[model samples]
Target chain A: MKGQRFLGLGYLGPYIIGLLVFTAIPFFGSLYLSFTKYDLMSSPDWTGLANYERLFTRDRTFFKSLNVTLLYVLLTVPLKLAFALFIATVLNYRLQFIGLFRTAFYVPSILGGSIAIAVLWRYMFATEGLVNMALATIGLGPIDWFGDPTNALLTITLLRCWQFGSAMVIFLAALQSIDKSLYEAAAIDGAGKVRIFFFITLPLLTPVIFFNLIMQMVQAFQEFNGPYIITQGGPLKATYLLPLYIYEEAFKKFNMGYASAIAWVLFTIITVLTLIAFWSSKKWVYYAGDKRS
Target chain B: MTDITTSNDLTMDETARAKRRAGLRLFSTAIRYALLFLVGFVMLYPLIWLVGASFKTNSEIFSGAGFLPQNPTLDGYIKGWQTSTPYTFGRFFWNSFLIILPKVIGTAISCTMAAYAFARFDFPLKKVLFGSVIAILLLPNVVTRIPQYILFRDLGWLDSFLPLWVPSALAGDAFFVFMLVQFLRSLPSDMEEAARVDGANSLQTLVYIVVPMLAPALISVCLFQFMWTMNDFLGPLIYLSSVDKYPVSLALKLSIDTTEAFEWNRILAMSVLAISPALIVFFAAQRYFIEGISSGGIKG
Candidate 1:
């Protein structure tokens, strides 16, 4: 028995070392660095809460990034989930060439956030690009996608939303698992399609919906590549997301301490939001095998 | 006489109801197909445009509104392959494979081993360890970037592929660990027990019995790691400073940054090339990929 236990430890040895060295150490190191003033050259000098204070009180870009990030989460999460659920529900039916459609819908997600896609996005939205040419046909002027502050964030949001395949796949899986008899019962009761959906499908799907919501929210909060590659958080910093801000503060300006503080703040926001979602799930999320309260 | 009249009226009502049902079914089917087509087009239009633009001339790219190029050219592919750097795009692709291959193998080995322990053993602190794996899965990579960068710099591991694949060997991706743990738990332990009763050791049982059963899950892990490492931008961007060590992701970005007159054709061509491997891999192993994603979500 003891030998077996020792062997188990041996099996787990690599992960244990990895967690301690990479995850645990860096995690604590960042927290410690958050309280100090350090560039890459010198040792960290303790300046307790100064980084946080400055971030809250004086840092305009910090607040700008925060607001931008919040708006992005608010806009993108719901839209992405709605898009996913809608497509999943549509594709859930028995139809010919359904696999092809699912694959097509998912391909964007697979290639998403690549420099290639970002570069393509930049071109497609450029002044004389395909988007503008399409707009011309519709009798509208060419809108400045990357230049104007108002439109820059929207352009990036669209890019993020375009990668809705992962969420859709999850929803599709959930939808398939749903008992078909419930739909039949609802239909037999003379319920309309919308009514049946709201009462039967939507209610049953709450758990998966909650799961997708939390995942997408966390992902959106940490989104980097879209805005970084396409807009570079430009046009008056309209699209300056938290990750972009943190990257610039740490790597670009070499303000490791300040960047660590911003990172902690971002971490807190994600944790709190996730907790709230979990807390809220108790009321609405329905687990199939669990007894109803 | 009254009974006969009532029966006849009921038959008439049934015919009308069936006709209405057939009409509604046709209407709904049309709507479903229309919506699917629209959404699919929206999802795939950008990629279609990308491939189309890659073959177009610089002038044609700006002027062309449609997906098809007026006059297709291979100059973009020819020049884009030989970048401004000393090495060609082939070198960058090779660099990507260098990182991806080892990382995939490392992830598979480490994650499976750890998952096997977690699933099979009743070791002390097992619950705590498993809980921590879940906790780590939620911890965003952004929070650890600065500290990790400093650590790697101190170790003099920067500007090399060591930082990319070494941690993977150590089971750094908690998600993969958690996934394999779930998969292992779902498998029957009867075979393992029988092997043990036959005096086969745990390691031997795992090698002979459990691993063969875990092949699909392991392949899923490998495919995922391959796709992610191939598409990874930030890790390579942060660790590798030299253009020579650059993966395709970094190489593609470098071209964009250094080019004075952004040749749309060449950039788009390289972009297509950069994305092609992922797309091809995805289409080929799409079943395993979807199974991994969907199962990982539900089980997690």
Candidate 2:
């Protein structure tokens, strides 16, 4: 211990090196690359704000992708969170086979984001497929799930939302940790179930809700597997999220500089939004974690 | 006589009221379970359909919204296993194993070491390094994907599995490292202190004393890395271009993209195979998975 001022560094060596090589370098490298025009075949040439200017000014696809991504994030995050909370609240009740219900509800979150689920979603929503057959059983006509622009985005959004089980499990943990005495006191005070939930339970749950919001928002922004597989950013690029656009531009179109610019813009957008959430959390997210307090 | 009759009537009324309340409670319980069952069924129906539909013929796959196949067959599984590539589905599964085994093992060792250092040692630049870990956790992979790809390409790491697993092996996943740090912080250091006093070296104490205590958390990390690697589409898609070297995720998609006529049943069959590993593992270790996610809610 006496001669070990830098012994900790020995422990940290591999990680530090990995961090430097894989993360720190690439992070700034992309930033530098964003300002230059580099195709894979040639060396990068300095392009000074040209990519950003073009993206903002002339690139219709860029704007469309941006619009689509924002809409997807906004739509999916709230829906998923709401479903998770609702299910968690219901499942929190003392009931028979509660664990079984929880497992059944959670199975989708594990399998939902996979390529298999995406493929299943594609078929289930296909024209003249299972969904249509079910609709017909009720004497309703078939709705175009992926063929239409509006439906295409909705289909992709549902895939993201179906994986709400993880968020629900988090909420369930937070909910279970709430003091039973608080609920007993609320009942003794002649508070209705709804009243106590809104006044007591909801406030206590804000921290978990905020955490889920941040995690889900990040994921919804970068949804790739669903959109790519199900709609392929199709029905007129309605499902063309920024990640999809990034993939297409960088890999398919060989637009490395432009793609990096898009990626940086994405990073900036997420950072600013997260910052705003943090700033706003002071108003709403109470960290009264200690139940006695 | 009049007083007795009135009291008797009141008792009867009270009895009826209690019975009604009990009936209402039963009804509510029934309603709650019904709703849970309905939602659970709907949530699981797609997976159920996938399994059942995997056995259906190509023509029958789209025949209805039903899950039960009329003439159940193994045709889809058979043909799907053969795949379009010269390499069969077995090859892809092996590739996935190759990636996951090392990646999960490496994550356990590397992240544990880094987390131990961060949690216990007061190294120079500790604050800055830890801050960078959080920053990396928050940073989207999209920003770094291209540069990393290029770097790997430069090092001739492309078209191989090295690029996929090596980063994780080195504790490049800050989320896992941070998770381990959070876990390590919660653990008491008394046993480790005793070991050190007994003249055990840091690594020796880590290997012998700390690891056993950290087993639950380490299991959680390994399971997460395993499932994530299995479900990863983008990594394999980006790095491994050869048909023979494809993981199940890529192999599943290769059939979809490379074929003209959609072999729906075969795809469905392969889809079942793809998700089965995650499903099996999840049920096997449900406790650790939920505990990790609840404690570590930031996993994406």
TM-score for all models, in order of appearance? 0.97, 0.95
Query: Candidate 1 lDDT, tens digit per residue, B59-97?
Result: 898886789988899988999898888999999999999
Look at candidate 2 and tell me the lDDT of residue B117.
90
What tens digits encode model 1's per-residue C-alpha lDDT throughout A110-145?
889788999989898899987898899989999999
Measured with DockQ on alpha carbons, how good is candidate 1?
0.77
Tell me the TM-score for chain B of model 2.
0.90
Clashing residue pairs, backbone N/CA/C < 3 A, model 1? none
DockQ of each: 0.77, 0.66
Q: What is the lDDT of residue A214 in candidate 2?
A: 85
List the global CA lDDT of all models. 0.90, 0.88
**Of the candidates shown, which would achieve the greatest DockQ relative to the real structure?**
1
**TM-score, chain B, each candidate:** 0.95, 0.90
User: For model 2, how does the per-residue alpha-carbon lDDT over B1-300 read when each residue is reduced to its tens digit?
Assistant: 999999999999999988997898788788888888888887888789889999999888888878889999999999888887788889999998998898899999999999989988888899999998888887889999999999999999999989987898889988888888888888999999999999999899999988898889899999988888998999998898888788889888998886547677888899999999999999999888888888776322
